[model samples]
Target: MSQRKMLQLSAGVLLFLLPWFGGLVSGELSYNFSQCLDFFYKETPPKGFHAAGYQSICQRYKNQYRFASLYHRQHRAPLYSAYRLSPTDGKRPRTSWMYEPQLVFSHASPEMEPFHIPVDQNVIDSQAVLLDYKNSNYTKGHLNPSMHQGTEEDREATFTLTNIIPQRAGSNSGPWNRLENEVLRKFKAFCNGSMYVITGAMPYTSGARWINNRVSVPEYIWSAYCCPSYSTSLPKSVKSFFPSYAAVGRNDRDSGEEIVPVNVRMKASMRGYDVRRMSVETLEGILKQRLAVTISLFQGECQ
Candidate 1:
């Protein structure tokens, strides 16, 4: 077989083996795998977006230097992978990894075939528009980030419209953003083998339609990190991303149900470990071990 054909065949085999043989061994939650990557099952609407396959967006960066908290595709998207780029006007060059999701996807559901929509790099770079909208309308948001994409191939891949989602600016750029980056940082500390991270939004209400590009906004965002078994301890820097207590907020609205209330005072304990001092090696080790702990503070009566 030609080189391209062999590559294709290998990808096909990998995808086929995912459900039966590959996942949990990597230390990811099987439940999360089913919810995020199960392609054969079709998820129903009203839940969230689901991922189809791995995109090669971060593949190139790894070769340059080991960067923690970054994620890449474990398996190729069915036919093509998507990029997950942000709108240009929002941040210049049109990017922001500071807190927002670099890209977003359909949350794989228990009942439906996994939606593996390939990001159309050509179309994304060619047609994406950051529209000026009045309040109440959702804004285009990305799950994958353009900063992570360095080459034409990388940039183009991110342009796929499928990775787009509508998101609230405060939440998207605030706690939600913090969680996404923290996950990326955690993976950088612990995973030595290839890891997969698929994120999507869960919407609260209906009719908050996406643009003509088929891009949709998310309601609740979910992600899964697959860590490989490793022999050594993680570096200190790696531990930085894993620091406890991620805060996400919801603005007060008249009609919307306050699923996530505004600044209601929530906190978690850090066990007195200084997050900034941890090394990258330590972080990677933690991820390899799948070590993460959480505690929540609930509002009274509303709990």
Candidate 2:
């Protein structure tokens, strides 16, 4: 056989053997996010976040670093995903979801692999599987939305299960969706340089919620961004949003209106899933209270 054919055969054999091989320990995923620092605003990951059962994944796809995710092992979801916004004319990579191999086997390939049948038990146990969301009445929420990515591969990389959370349909398609679009508009119109975003899931302060008793569902979704370089001539209404801006959307309307109040004027379906825009500092304060931990999304507040 030719050299190419031989290499392909070897890779196939390795995939076949990976599942049955019991030698691999399903231990802690220690992969660092340093390789993908370009995704962050100042080549810096969020700081002051000290937590166990979390893995820093430098999201790799198609042999390139696309983004970074702070994945939570126990929740089977990401704490947050950070990426620099890029303009895109690409469509969503629906039905082409993938999972992180490094989460299962430490020595496995770092690239996100498309979901396949007969998924290994280790893989299912390590992170959220497709089965967890099927008929669960919750939508697969993208922490790093595909519309924010510039290239097709970058969009596809956001579909990884590690970067998803169980979200209500109302929030996914309603106010939260609008918030994402608004951010994109700001990037396209005002931002002269990189717009670094960190979107995350916020758990309820009381207790945890789950889908299929496996993947944890977030009570609220929060996002923040830092854009240091932008047009000097800005509208008064949007001027406060420059440098850094943030928002929190209601995943469960019944959860309460303290963070984001319901817009009674809207149609019934979209009324409760309100997204409240605020300053990055305000969002940080809310996150610090909810998470019981201090996390600085930008380096020296994007200094």
Candidate 3:
């Protein structure tokens, strides 16, 4: 059947009656990241901020665990996504965007499903929907980008809205995108084994921005990796990046320079959205100060 025809199907055929899981309360969604533990370093997730309004999701696609995301129920955005870095294999998948049904219905399908017309009201109220981004200034930025994954299925799995946030075009395609490529280069050159990565969004301290009054726009885009196993034969310049290194990019032009500075001299499209590269420890310090929480992104700082 054609795409248009499939979407034209009666709502009766699509609407589902989900079973309520007992013992689960309202404004509460917490599941152990048990299913997707392999994506994290040492099979351990980022520590420090697991309070109310935050839910854990094991991003399952095609009945296989791909990555994990810490989604914020109130913000309708993800706090971060943890995944194992994979080499790119083919063209980007033109798959339709998806949402996490488990956020709305406890016993719904574990996999991410594409949005259909007349979207379920509960799903929209629970999480971000396609309409939230329609004609909006912000872009549906993936915390776990497709280029970072190796297999086709792995790439497709990154399209879920649970793994995305509202990002500006300058930061998403410019400096931040460059930072991702840089990490890929370092991974292909120095890493001998696995490389685990955790990428997250850092919200503003005050005057938080929202898209369509639905999704929260992040102030800074931060990412870190832990590749404990690597080739000992490394260059002096690139030695500091081993095991663990981190970076934070400016998502707003007028944001403070404390976390990331704005480059006023660059072209209009790329200026003001600069990316600051630093050691994992430095990144953690900034995270602590800004978030007002003592958080560790890697195990023992990837020692």
Candidate 4:
């Protein structure tokens, strides 16, 4: 063969192989939640939250601990993410959203590096590449919200999509945000010890719903906290919140009002997404009914 012809052929072959080789190097083949329990408190993670084919994720960022999540592959979103609430830190870390590398890359061994992987050319095609919440009506709502963290790094770790779900603007900015703040206040004022929290979603009963066919849109968002110890002298207003409390917030306006009743008197913007706080048992009852499984958020019901 002529030298020029050989060079051209070699170039063409390199071009053809780039995409495949790049994918392999990027760790696209091995993205499941096999090591999700590492983030759980005492390594004793919650039970009965896993559905058939569920994936667990221990959210890490730059080797900094963040939170843990249980992902539903079929729904293409997180069922829940658990984290211990750290005392409030005033500094908010700059938003640099990331994805879980272990979810997409086989070479990206669990706990080998920071849990959050940067977006690059290699992982552009993986299913673990989550949808960007740009130009969309829905917000990229966090299950482990940043407000509950104590340090800038811990707050920033909550930005990863593995710890987020598609939530309504009303719920994310209004009642749900209020609920998170309230919980933070209680944790700071009353709890003298670590407070374990698990926040998750409840999909529609009949079928799954997706946002832009890329992410699951939950029917409702629920959260529960277990504080084994707290101030003995509690204010009457928040007396019932100590030890444990749970709440379920509506995500859709058209859904029935059985689990979370909508208040007709509230303004239109906040009317449909009311968050109803209840005891841990009540939340479990609702979860059992919706998820069709025995749901236990805390061991011994936080004792």
Candidate 5:
């Protein structure tokens, strides 16, 4: 081969390999919430919901970003996942669980998918994997549900362990599910503008609860939404839900009813862990009392 031709081919190969080499050198690139400031309303996340040991993670999956979360390292779970609801989403994406590479190692920038890359100890703790759910009564519950996203990619980004919490099957598949559907229906029928949603879990009052000593189990799972614009004429049944709404689902059926009152009429299987819908202020009140922090989930209370 001519020397000139060899030089040109070598240059082309170098250009093609640069990106891969850069990724290898930098490790993986994971993002923080500040990296995607546009996703939040006015570039402002929730306030007064901080904890001592929690770390903030901005979830990026398959190059499609979705939301941000406050992850509790010791608990091996998320305190909450915040996302803006997409109105055009039609179907859920077929995807697997992913993890934040930076959580376990500082060298990585982007997130990692276990199927695409070998599972590494520096990614997530061994107890945080999907295998932990096996033979367990609890389910891997999502704080930021995929159904709220606008596209398949955005939906798929929600399936990360940092966005999951240990939830009882009764709450995960029953009352909690109903609350999600109700929120979806309201968002579809009433909301006319961007909707900001934040879902999180509350730890037990006395001490930390654990699943196999790996993941922390929450005492209650709570969710709230703020829609700045919406239909003026709402149905009487849902009239109170406009602008903002919140609900708390019980993780333990045996727990007291000071916050979320269980429905006595529900069947045996779905009776406990009932979800009670309330006003945004009311939800915040409960959260403030339980979390011991004055949480402001929306800007100016979505006024």
Candidate 6:
């Protein structure tokens, strides 16, 4: 069926169920949205969401570092998939899977910590849905690559469709790829448990501008994640894993590659705050403060 027809049919089906399920508030109705549209549509909602103050924590933990520039929406169910971040914006959208989460270091220019965001399982096993990585000319750019999520479970979660985005193949594979690997090495040495990660892409000019809109390419990719708690001091080998926050020529414009082109800038803005190292308790406190701040910023009434 056509896109319009599918949308209309889905809408009609949803409309009929809305009132009976007590509008969007009902769990069943919410589940439908999660299964149909959410990037992270798992078999169940994430346990993280129910974790005490998770929503609040995410809202208040104002991050100085972000793993990527695009964060779309959280999965409605835990069993569905992980949240997704996308660099591109269009009505004709190409979204990544929740299953393919990649650990990305935002703000590579000032390089910081690595964040791990998992994707949904449904995004992988279910071939019924269209995945952003399947047909688009873009690479399967992971927000939290498997190499960094740590555990095998975490690594597997990276395959979900929601964690992907349209990325220039060269940028995705070269410097950007190295940065992610380096972060994983750090975690193995110093991290304790549950290191929160946030990643996304940043548009040089914000709003809904497409790749076709601007003649300029992405001058830089920003990534940062904090190791809230560490079990021990990281060794020199661990530190060695960290790449220079900036890459001079990861994108070679001379190649005239078929994929989207990322610009090669000798220098980039290294504007960002420090990736503060602290005890888990202290990190929790900081996260609470930031989450509160974010909630207030977003007009969230729940405190």
**Candidate with maximal TM-score:** 3
Can you write out model 2's per-residue Cα lDDT over 224-252, one digit (the tens) per residue?
99999999999998999998999999888
Ranked by lDDT, the better of candidates 1 and 2 is 2
The 10-residue segment of model 4 with minimum total lDDT is 12-21
Compute the lDDT of residue 13 as modeled in candidate 5.
15
What does candidate 1's lDDT look like per residue over 29-144, in tens digits? 11122222211112101111222232322222212211111122221011112222121222224322121022223221111112234533532332232331234355445455
Off by over 4 Å in 3: 1-31
TM-score of each: 0.38, 0.88, 0.89, 0.81, 0.84, 0.38
Instruction: Write one digit per residue (lDDT tens) for candidate 6, span 1-303.
Output: 753344334422211100111112222122223332322211112111111111100110122212222122222111112232222122221323332122121211222112224323532232112332345444656656655533333344454334454456656765566665555555555656433334433222232222322111222233434443455455664542221111112222333322223333522321111122222233223323422321110001101
lDDT of each: 0.30, 0.79, 0.80, 0.70, 0.72, 0.31
Error of 2 at 257 (Å): 1.6
Residue 204, candidate 6: C-alpha displacement in angstroms: 3.8
lDDT of 5 by residue, 114-166 (tens): 53346556444622777666777899899988887878778778888878898
In model 3, what is the error at residue 21, expressed in angstroms?
22
Residue 274 C-alpha lDDT in model 4: 94
Rank the models by lDDT, top first: 3, 2, 5, 4, 6, 1
| Model 1 misplaced regions, further than 4 Å | 1-137, 147-152, 205-216, 230-262, 265-303
User: Residue 235 of model 3: what lDDT?
Assistant: 94
lDDT of 3 by residue, 43-160 (tens): 6666664343356688888888899887776678887899999889887898988888888887777888888878989999888998988888888888999999999999999999
Query: Looking at model 3, which ten-residue stretch has the lowest summed lDDT?
Result: 12-21
Model 4, residue 121: distance off in Å is 7.8
Best by lDDT: 3
Q: How many clashes in each structure?
A: 54, 0, 0, 5, 7, 65
